[model samples]
Target: MMDDFLTVIALIISLNAVICLYRAAVGPTTQDRVLGVNIVGTKALVVVVLVTFIQTESFFLDVALVYALLLFVVTVAVSRYLEAEGWKEVA
Candidate 1:
């Protein structure tokens, strides 16, 4: 019963993550798109962990961890570049 519940929740997360991706693709500003991507990435981590639990394979969570780390690095890099370009967070 718990397994089924987890699966259902994972599916919901997947659907929401897809919407986040669509938003990322069509967002008006780079920051808006980046926010979308960040949210999607967070959802991906949860999805991956759920999959790992469903499959009884703990190793899948390691992949999610690495993905999160990479996402952080990419976000930081983009933020630095934007800062250098004089993009202000005045909004």
Candidate 2:
């Protein structure tokens, strides 16, 4: 029962991730695209964790950790790039 639930949730997450990926690809601005990328990365991380749990494997956890680290690095890089491009605090 629990496995079935996980499978369903995984499918949902995968679907949403794909949609977010499309958003990242077609965003009107770099900042919008970066935000979409961040969201997709986050969803991917969650899906990885769920797969690890469903399969009872430690290897997928390692993959998830690496992905999470990469996601962090990419998000930070995007923020730095935006800041460098004259994007300033709007308040």
Best by TM-score: 1
lDDT score for candidate 2 against the true structure = 0.90
Model 1 lDDT-worst window of ten: 82-91
Per-residue lDDT over 28-81 for candidate 1, one digit per residue giving the tens place of the 0 to 100 score: 777887888889999998999999988889899899999889989988888678
Candidate 2's TM-score reads 0.84
Once model 1 is optimally superposed onto the true structure by TM-score, how far is the C-alpha of residue 39 displaced, in angstroms?
0.7
- TM-scores for all predictions: 0.85, 0.84
Q: Cα miss at 54, model 2 (Å)?
A: 1.1
Q: Model 1: number of clashes?
A: 0
